[model samples]
Target: MEDGKIKGKAMVLSGFDQEESAREALEQALKEAGLAREAIGIIVTTGNGRKAISFAKGDVTEARAAALGAVFLYPTARTVIDVGAEESRAIKCDATGKVLDFAVNEKCAAGSGAFTEAMARALEVPLEELGPLSLRATQTIPMNAQCAVFAESEVISLIHSKTEKADIARAVHDGLSSRVVAMVRRVGLNTELVLIGGVAHNPGFVESFKRTVGLDDVRTAAEPDFVGAIGAALAAAE
Candidate 1:
């Protein structure tokens, strides 16, 4: 995209093994885009695996990627909350997408997507069901554990007590939302907040997140999963 708009995009998860798989997936994406390696002028990578992406010319920090990507997707975006598999980030940025400040929570899975995955498994529901199930919750149930491992046990207890799955699901979303919002507040959350990352696909989490943060509206991309790569692509274009 150095002198052009994005012509193609693709994604394939390797489940944290290494960069080789990601590279293979990239090659596939490039193939789908009808381009060859020699057609590209530069390459940039981002995220934890960035250091291992041997073919890349350089890298960008995940915070910068998320911030810039949010602004690119939504120009009005002033704050971005990025939630990945193992961690979460809150980024404050200016109108031009320059990161002003940011905060992160990586000490535990409490605020991460892993937290929801674990609870979903415990509930014996498809992971995709968590959001909708929570939405149907007729009563509020607060979760007590911030540690995902311990929280899994608490979920079991809720099950043994015959608590409605919907209520339990909402409780789980509530717990994760609180932790994510804490990071957002630390970064001085303002109007035009955008939520990105794989977890953002969950409507339940989105609603819970907005309500917990006392916001009436939030922004998101149509296909947010590629925001980081898009940012890296933007860097390469520069």
Candidate 2:
């Protein structure tokens, strides 16, 4: 986290029963950035797993960190739509990278990445392939379920109906985008929209977001997942 840039990063997937994947990511980022643990100055943490890392000097909110991180990387960024594994949020930012307004969907699982994972499992398709496969669909399929549990059942029904997995995948992403779109609309769409978090890796979701929100030109950090970490580092530098 020197010079406002992540040095190295590592990740320990949930399968390992690890909460602070950043512990490994931090070591890797430091090594990648070419710094030793002792050489580091101060430690700052943010995001859902902040409490799991006992070594942090301080912590910041995800919206604050994400705003700063996106602005730091893309100077023109004004809004950030962060879709995480279990929750999603939309943040409106000003020129100075200060968050002006925000909306979060933490109560529901249907709008999060976990929903897509569940659908993929129901369709007997690999989770990683959901996004690309969804992109292959020629016609949009409507998904009515508003809950992940029901959505999972819906996906199973789609599979039983012999519906193309691609259409089902697209519908899943569209459902997520619809939820996120509601949040973004609440804050109002500003230029230089940015999408962050693990779900941004889903290309299908990205396109669905653009279409549903009616805004393309969405910006993303080079290391999208680390935007929050980058913002925390910038705060630490300050």
RMSD to true structure for each model, in Å: 1.2, 1.8
lDDT of 1 by residue, 17-114 (tens): 65877788678878877999889888889887888888889999999988877788788899988998888999999987789999998868888999
How does candidate 1 fare on TM-score?
A: 0.96
The window of 10 residues in a row where model 2 has the poorest summed lDDT is 11-20
In Å, residue 182's CA in model 2 sits off its true spot by: 0.3
Reference-based TM-score of each model = 0.96, 0.93
> What's the true lDDT of residue 72 in model 2?
85
For model 2 the local lDDT of residue 8 reads 66
Instruction: Please name the candidate that would achieve the greatest lDDT relative to the true structure.
Output: 1
Each model's lDDT: 0.87, 0.83
Q: For model 2, how does the per-residue alpha-carbon lDDT over 1-238 read when each residue is reduced to its tens digit?
A: 6575556665546434344466777777777777888998988888777766788888889999989988888888888888988888899998778999998889678878888888888878888888899999888989999998999899889889989888989999999899989988899888678899899998888889888878656665567787887888888898
Each candidate structure's count of clashing pairs: 0, 8
